[model samples]
Target: MPVKYQQETAQITWEAAQALIEAVLKEGAAQKIAFSIAVMDAGGHLRAFGRADEAAFLTAEIACDKAWTACFFGQPTHIWNSLVQESHMAPLASHPRLMAVGGGYPIFYQGRLIGGLGVSGGTYEQDQEAAVKALSFTGFDKL
Candidate 1:
């Protein structure tokens, strides 16, 4: 048999990114909080982004960082807080793109990691809520 080291992986479409952004916005509105949102491909590249008029300016970058962090780690950005508590993982706290807060989640489809989603501008818990709601509402798994 031939070596099969490579395999196909799903990529999040531009339209899906946009839809996720819209879904995030909807959830933010429901929560009565403005949010900055970002979506990234599996490679941690930004695919789509948005910031509500009332969202803090800093939220934009935070949202992007959250998405990138989630994609880069293949887990929710919030997990970094607990993960970094380990003595050896503490060094990760210095990485510029590592967002150890909340509002970041890996996007999964059929057990395949496809991309990431992040939301900001509210409390970390609120951000997490919005991220999860938006992911499921958009037919993606928040894993």
Candidate 2:
């Protein structure tokens, strides 16, 4: 007898992505800051995005790259930045599509990696704050 095998994967749903983006936008508005937010699926595919008025035009792409980097590494980009700096691996920071910035975070649900969130167009601390705030609303920040 032969057995069948199956594979399963988790992804960030459209509704959740929209909610996260909205929350980030609201946070940015409250801070009187403009931002570009991007959400990417576990496979590093773009799911949703938003850019606040007056945000830098380049932020759109930067936000996406940040999200991709987070999903790719399964960790916050800031952590990667620190690791690179501490290890003196400066060359890794120059890699294309791998931004070790402070605004990118990998999203997890029930111990499973679901997706990534990226926020840009503000200082690193500001962007990290907005991203974490948005993730908190989705109940994914603690993971």
Candidate 3:
């Protein structure tokens, strides 16, 4: 028997991403409210994605950035949004890759950070809801 040496890279599967998208769509969200959903690996690199028909070009990029920000910062992007509101922290806007916006959330499994999700192209609340739902549908249900 020959032993094979292959390095395995951590990743989220496409089925998981699709499940998330279906869940979000089933929530009565309209097609006109297109969404750019992004998923990032544990290292904050893009793993998978989906963009609705009406989603804007910027939507995808922003969504990815939000996911990366959440995963890399190890906290909900909403926290960064909130912190930016403080007079003392306004300068964080200048921080490279720091997005003071909603729609970004971390995905955790077994109490470990495994990935992140970001949704765009809807109202802030809607975007947040979709992102959370996506995480839940992906089997990180408690996220």
Q: Largest lDDT belongs to which candidate? A: 2
User: Better model by lDDT, 1 or 2?
Assistant: 2
lDDT at residue 94 of model 1 (Cα atoms): 90
TM-scores for every candidate against the unseen true structure: 0.93, 0.91, 0.79
Superior by TM-score: candidate 1 or candidate 3: 1
In order, candidate lDDTs are 0.89, 0.90, 0.76
TM-score ranking from best to worst?
A: 1, 2, 3
Q: Write model 2 residue lDDT over 1-143, tens digit each, in one string.
A: 87769769999999999999999999999999899999999999999999998899999998999999988889888887777786578778778999888999998988888899999989989999999888988788564
- For candidate 1, report its TM-score: 0.93
Per residue, candidate 1 scores C-alpha lDDT tens digits across 1-143 of 89999988788899999998998888888878999999999888898898888999999999999999988788998889998899999998999999999999998888888888889999999999988888888888646
**After TM-score superposition, what is the CA distance of residue 106 in candidate 2 from its true location, in Å?**
0.4
In model 3, which regions exceed 4 Å deviation?
1-11, 25-32, 86-89, 141-143
Give the winner by TM-score.
Answer: 1
**Candidate 3 local lDDT, 90-129, one digit each (tens):** 9977877776688888777767777777777888788887
For model 1, the stretches where C-alpha displacement exceeds 4 angstroms are 1-6
